[model samples]
Target: MWIFGWKGPSGFSASSTAEEVTQGIDGSALTAIVTGASSGIGVETTRVLALRGVHVVMAVRNADAGQNVKESILKEIPSAKIDVMDLDLSSMASVRKFASQYQSSNLPLNLLINNAGVMASPFMLSQDKIELQFATNHLGHFLLTDLLLETMKRTARESDIEGRIVNVSSEGHRIAYSEGIRFDKINDESGYYTWYAYGQSKLANILHAKELARRLKEEGVEITANSLHPGAIISTNLMRHHGLINTVGQMLGKYFLKNIPQGAATTCYVALNPQVKGVSGEYFLDSNIGNPSAKAKDADLAKKLWDFSCTLTNPK
Candidate 1:
């Protein structure tokens, strides 16, 4: 049944739902933070995690939308523990503030899903003057993870529960520019191609996860970091930037694209599945481990990207 690199175990497929993959898993003792949980795959990921009895925090840019999603989930699962926290991943100040607020709460961090991202859009800069897609999709999550590392490590050591970090990368990572990350020209619009820029950001997502997993292992921290391609999902607002092309493409590809819940399956699988415990520094697809591009597997490139990210996120 495996075709085009989209195959999983017998029980799971491209159409498998998040709930199906997470069945029999009791997450009552765990706490998780899911970024961009207001809609699309984020909402479904939050719902399934909360349904499994995990305390889920919906981190979103729009507070009102996040509250609405939280309320909707509460209506379905009366006992579901959910909280809506403001987090705008495009701004460095916002990332810092959100991390600070969460740290002040003294909550034990169990899962941090770097699921928020932007897709192909006209060239622009984030508030920090970095390219928008690179900043929001990679740098913000990079900084957030750095800020929360100690908390996750502490929680894992004290609770004796392995912590997990899932970065929602995309298969589009392969379509990045020839240079991969274009580190020297991130904000240069003259050389920018929207889709390639988005690809670079997604590529960075995988690289970030790879490097973090390596560091955690080197430090003997009982935490795991992994990344995955969530599939081409049509229902998500990620296509809002495409305008007319988005509508046309969705119309043509709706039947082939994964639904929101199905799109979120791989993420939930990597996040809560016992089968993948201790498995880190890998790329996943369709609820199973899969290979990424050769460039993506380059450890030297990952380390280089990590160092660049640190400088961008925490400059002296």
Candidate 2:
């Protein structure tokens, strides 16, 4: 029963825009990796960070789409330092390749935003024969983070600055997978429920952050791992495959929820804001450390997920 006391700092809000969240933050010395950067909140989040002179690596599956996103950012901020990298989160091989390339660069990563995801799509599997949502949303990021943990730790020690990893989760995680992470059923090729699987994956994101934080703490590392819900952003085409769901989500967005910039507030806040410089393993929403469900704080499940991820990634 981990109690989450929503002690919001000054200048934070549910409606805070990405620019507002990172106002006055100097990121010229930082390097960040943002997944799902091809479009939507992922793109907007990277744009905000890049505007601050942060060298942002746009990790996406499609090179052409990534180039388009890079152009859009360059158009907005001509001085934005944006690099496009091939990262198909659905494939373990692609994830490994990206990790290898990143590690070989020897550049310290200041931030990592696991923002790529699919929602409410038809059931599918990755090339690794894992559930699509679980593989891409949670497992892929899990492996990538594990692969780069050493680099982040080294960077923190060398620069004496906090290295951050932000797992972009959703409020939807609260609705499903409440019964605990089903490690046994994770690879049910036949039991394909988009919403349920998506929920489980999102929960895994939160769990991953919690577990990573615990491990880093034990290892005396300065890299912080935190999870955040980006709120309901209409700009992200997560529901494009589900026509009715997309329509309803859009309508709800028009009526309530944050705009694209606002939706990305908590994510940007967790990634670079000074208020949470050392805060890790916490679940945030609306730019504040909000209360997660009882299940979200299950340390045991977090450890279980971490172990499962280790087996999946086979990190030595």
Candidate 3:
């Protein structure tokens, strides 16, 4: 847990908690949508953001779970404006429905935190016939961001404030397959390996941000897009698929793995920190800029991903 003492240029480190990173920051007028807000780091991220006065919309696959989280937060901060919306990232139909509902509410979107993800799950296909990890982690977010982009742009333009999009990637991105994306073989069951698939999805998260940032910059939009590694928080259900890993983690995790607060720190920092103003298309770790694998930095791959995602998420 001492990933804390080692500070970065941001004067924060892996040990910093979400509340600590966002202290003194007032987000009273901002509105944010955080996916997977019912559990793990997503819960902490939502809580801290609400604490900072941001109107938070919890987009979770489970409405009951999301309501529970919302209630718990409200119990602590009665003034916090929070809403729960059902969203199943693995289903493109659900994403569109959620986006439509959100837009219809006419809520201003200042921050988008793509924090929900599945890790190292056994091979499975989403309702759309896409690989589950890639579908939920990368493609879901891509479409959600695309759908809400107009609102974010309008908010920035009308309010004269910067908009931010944060993608929660992982260090596991460096562990992907030789092709990085496995684009041509995305659903090839015979070739699928759990870790590689998860890595590929995480890598996609970074590339999505890179390509999105580039496009936003070209358009001269005030919105910035970036990705981050939220550290390994062993208590989360992210590793639920691996019985052996969970066993080992229970024994040795508390000694080294990040606690929930630490895991959510970088997210809160990247989302609300004034120090991050104008930065985009970068990878962050421990609340500071960190290097990603060369493959994760490939601009052509990013552009290709953008086009590919467009086809997959296209309504027609």
Candidate 4:
């Protein structure tokens, strides 16, 4: 279970909590944009950063929920600098609007956490008619990153630090077929299974990190992108759209999986740890780099997915 360039704790299990992982990290001068920051793992991750003095932009689909999350954080840490921004990742149009506004503000974005995602939900179409999971979780983030690359570059240069984009993938990526991203059937119309489709979208997150890292390096930008699996946790509405079987599976997960804080551990670890400052395009868990499936490391597939995503989300 070894892979090249993996440099996290060895044999680390998935029970670490976000508060535990970020015990001593100082985040005073950092500004971050974290999607799905309104609840669950996202909310916990935001809290961890805010407690450390980092200004965070909670990018959520619903402005009301985003504001509520901000108030909750303010209540916990009265001096916490938190802002809410509207971003519906399922729509390319919304992603563009959000990125445009953020860039216009000229905030030095040290971290971008693509933490929002949906799972095992009934099949639904995005504004562009793509599958819901893939559209919101993968493609939206892809476009948003490209849109914000300039801001990230500026932040990296000004701070002399490696900028970061953390894609919150899942271990379920193991279910992706050997062929990798199935561009032809990306919409999954003919043979759609909720879990399988969710798996494919999660796999896209990993590949997006890998490919984006390579491209940013080639362009001489000091930015790092990586993916992680937040350990299974209850309390998130990610399963809100799930069917009975999926709901049952989520209940079973509570028995064996980490709690919400525990689930957010790897995400917080990757976002702020100096130990992993230069670690890009790697899969992580439990504050440690984990080995991805062989297919997950296929550069060709990653490139293909990137090109396909650009086309889907950035039509000329």
Q: What is the TM-score of each candidate against the true structure?
A: 0.96, 0.94, 0.98, 0.93
Q: Write the per-residue lDDT of candidate 1 for residues 1-316, one digit (tens) a residue.
A: 2224344653577777899889999999999999999988999999999999999988999999999998899999999999889999999999899999999999999999999989998989999999999999999999999999999999999999999999999999999999999988989999999999999999999999999999999999999999999987546789998778778767765666677788899999999989889999999988988899988999999999999998998889
* Residue-level lDDT for 85 in candidate 1: 91
- Report the lDDT of model 4 for residue 33: 93
- Candidate 3: tens digits of C-alpha lDDT, residues 1-316: 3554888899998788899999999999899999999999999999999999999999999999999999999999999999999999999999999999999999999999999999999999999999999999999999999999999999999999899999999999999999999878998998899999999999999999999999999999999999999987547878889888888887787888788888899999999999999999999999999999999999999999999899889957
Residue 139 of model 4, lDDT score: 94
Per-residue lDDT, model 2, residue 96, is 90
Full candidate order by TM-score, most accurate first: 3, 1, 2, 4
By TM-score, the best candidate is 3
Ranking by lDDT: 3, 1, 2, 4
Give all candidate RMSDs, comma-separated. Answer: 1.7, 3.5, 1.2, 3.5
Q: Which pairs clash in the backbone of model 3?
A: 4-15
Q: Between candidates 2 and 3, name the one with more favorable TM-score.
A: 3
lDDT of 4 by residue, 1-316 (tens): 1113233454234665677777788898899999999888999999998987889999998888889888988998999999999999999999999999998887889999999998866788999899888898899999999999899999999999788999999988988655656788877677877778888889999999999999987888889999998866555777777456557767776767567887888888899878787788899987898888777898998999988987887678
- Report clash pairs, candidate 4: none
Alpha carbon lDDT of each predicted model: 0.91, 0.85, 0.94, 0.85
Clash number for each model: 0, 0, 1, 0
Root-mean-square deviation of Cα positions for candidate 1 versus the true structure, in angstroms: 1.7
- Of 1 and 4, the candidate ahead on TM-score is 1
Q: In candidate 4, what residue range of length 10 has the lowest lDDT sum?
A: 1-10
